[model samples]
Target: MDRPVSKVREAKLELYRKKGNIHAKEVTGRFNTLRWGMVWLTQTIFYGLCWINWESAGSVRQAVLFDIAHEKLYLFGLVLWPQDALLLALVLIIAATALFLVTALAGRLFCGFACPQTVYTSIFTWIEARIEGDHLARLRLDAGPMSLRKLLIKTAKHSLWAIVAIWTAVTFVGYFTPIRELLPTVVALKTGPWEAFWLIFYAAFTYVQAGLAREAVCQHMCPYSRFQGVMFDPATSNVAYDRQRGEPRSNRRQAGQTGDCIDCGICVQVCPTGIDIRDGLQYQCINCGLCIDACDQVMEKIGAPLGLIRFASETALVAPEKHRPWYTRPRIGAYAALLLIFCGMGVWTLEHRSLLLVDVLRDRGALLRETAEGEIENAYTLKLMNLSEVPRDFIVRVAGMPGARIVGEERFTAEPGSIRPVSVTVAAPSDSSLSGIQPMLFSIQAADDRSIEVVEKSSFILP
Candidate 1:
């Protein structure tokens, strides 16, 4: 069902990796700092956006609410209706294309830095380290026998994890239901069945994925990790270890020890995914740069130049001076072009999008009737959807027939963000040049603004 996976080169450290529950040693460096920074940034947006309110049609509503009950997606001043589905599709396409472009240029950069799984996993692990002590201490604790102190500590840790997961789920559901109402309903034990189900389901999902699954999700569950190899090339930059400089690792300072590596295994311990970078670009590697940070610190203390492990392409490592340019790669270039085209199309469509939608349905009761003046009459129903944030009056008009004029009300009103159906009647002389199911056009226009108008095609039947 999924793409083929690349095998990781086996080494003696494979035994260490088999140890249950990888406890990644906390490392401090620019990349670690950047990762935490992303964690804060992403969580802030996810948790805070639902609290913002906007004024719409003389009523206050959530600024970014996806009101599925009303089939409306409100984004600040923009109100998208079902007819604007193309915009949603375009946005998804643009996001996927951008991800592919970024992946082709730098393999798994998103998985490393900004993936929700990685971010939440990092948070959960940090909490674990804080409560259970460092990686070595945790290993010791797990191996030790159960005791009162261990039980208390475990209880506290799981309690906090449940709280975080439950709150995360609540914030996610707030996007669909108004958070203001949903919170009160939840506290009052009055939440709807759907709300209760999602709250419990999402909380469990987050707890298991972030607190328990951890690296297993990235290594085995994520399809992106499985398929990312196809996007990489010899020149694609990724977290890599320089075997030329780091091979023949020696633990002791002795003569003929040309390799810079000291066999400290610090890189392996710091890796969240628990895969050695020296394993030659394994699918399990998330390109998180933690190993690079760990290796650089070791390099500095040992008086060796930094970058034993760094973001270097295979071609760059083999021949630094002859690596191909990113722009020259056909696959990367194609991905970049696709991202631009989709983004441009989305912007253009939104800029020219109309605020009025119209549909015509011929009244089945009387497709054709004769007035007392010997005139053929037709009846139609017009469904007008007003997408604006304010209510306004709309004018109706008919065309595509000679001397065909509206006999009933030509002006009607629609509420803001509501659909209104109106019955319209048209009459034409029986001696008209056209007869028998002639094509007709129905147009609806805003009475206040000529620019807001829509024309739909129907038919006028005649005997």
Candidate 2:
């Protein structure tokens, strides 16, 4: 009996060191509602955007298209060229700044509620619970021998997982290919090589990460889980154990003799990542607050006060006099300021975007020629890009030189979404004042709407 007691104590110590699988009990609260709201909002937008299409005035429709082959990105009314890749860079910076601000202010709120991994894992786990039963039952089912009932349950679960994963992949590819055409092609197994590869790869990734490696993705695969500590401060809120209120834990019967904690270990059981909140913050803690809900339930059942495990800061629970407000935190303020600046830049860039582009290149073979009319003339090739949806007729004109005249037709027609090249001659009288490489402005005004103008600067040479 003495030896068995010693072995039991040793086993308990080992279990304490290594966390067991958390069969997190379901609970309802304000945070849980907020999490579901985010899930609805994000998934709705993601799936909705995949099916939306718009008809442009050009041959091609104005759908969400990233025409990488043509080096163009079309977003609603905006057309971005490769030279404007800075916009993508600015977007990334803004995203980073927003993450920093959120992390400093709320501590892994994004990870817990809005992150794709977390959201998908929640969905996958919900499906698992529906098919395999609750936490204890799921464990039992996994350990039991293979049977027809188990096979049927597993098949249903995996079939649903595959459908969700395939849908996710399809939506991701829709950003590049028109979903209407891509879907039919996918069904026929006739998709382009790159598109087919990406669809399969993304589907496999979703299946493995969400369906199989749920918690392992957070604990071992995600770099964010490892570096989240650097963003943390004493003021940052996290799922923290209130050790002062629940230490020297004992059973519910002897509650007054010890702390409020009954040592029921509900907090440990509910954690999806299988972590013990009572052990203090670990890298695996996503700050999801499922543990808080679990502990709250335990406290209520034992006739004890709640918040034995809660969303709080280490300093707030430990030091009474040094508590600081969230906004006053220096790191959070800096991150917020940066996010605001980038957001402003993005808005400004969108507002001032151009609808057309022009490039004028002077003929290099012969700079200036003496026409039969004995006037000094220069040859130029004008490249006009009609970036708008409507076909536009443009009247070409020259400025910056007095008495400069166009030799031929002054107007040309450009098809919508097409680049047209027109060759024209600019002439000046032999005696007219002109020297080598005189600065000139070639302007094109839309015949339909004079307000839309594209201008390019070039030089006219006089020999």
RMSD of each: 5.2, 3.3
Give the best candidate by lDDT: 1
Error of 2 at 147 (Å): 3.3
Runs of candidate 2 with Cα error greater than 4 angstroms are 1-23, 58-63, 67-74, 77-79, 253-257, 431-433
What are the models' TM-scores?
0.94, 0.89
**In candidate 2, what are the lDDT values of residues 415-455, reduced to their tens digit?**
76688999989997676455677788888899888778977
The backbone clash count of each candidate, in order, is 0, 1
In the range 1-463, model 1's lDDT, one tens digit per residue, is 1111111223324535777888888999989998899999999999999999998667899999999999999999898988899999999999899888888888998999899999999989988988999988887888789999999988888888999999999999999999999999988889999999999999999999999999999999999988888888898999999988887766664546658877777899888998878878999988889998999999999988999999999999989998988989999889988988999999999998999888888898867999899999998888888889889799998899777889979999998888899999999889756779888888888999999988888887877
Best by TM-score: 1
Clashes in model 1: which pairs? none
Error of 1 at 50 (Å): 0.8
On a 0 to 100 scale, what is the lDDT of residue 460 in model 2? 73
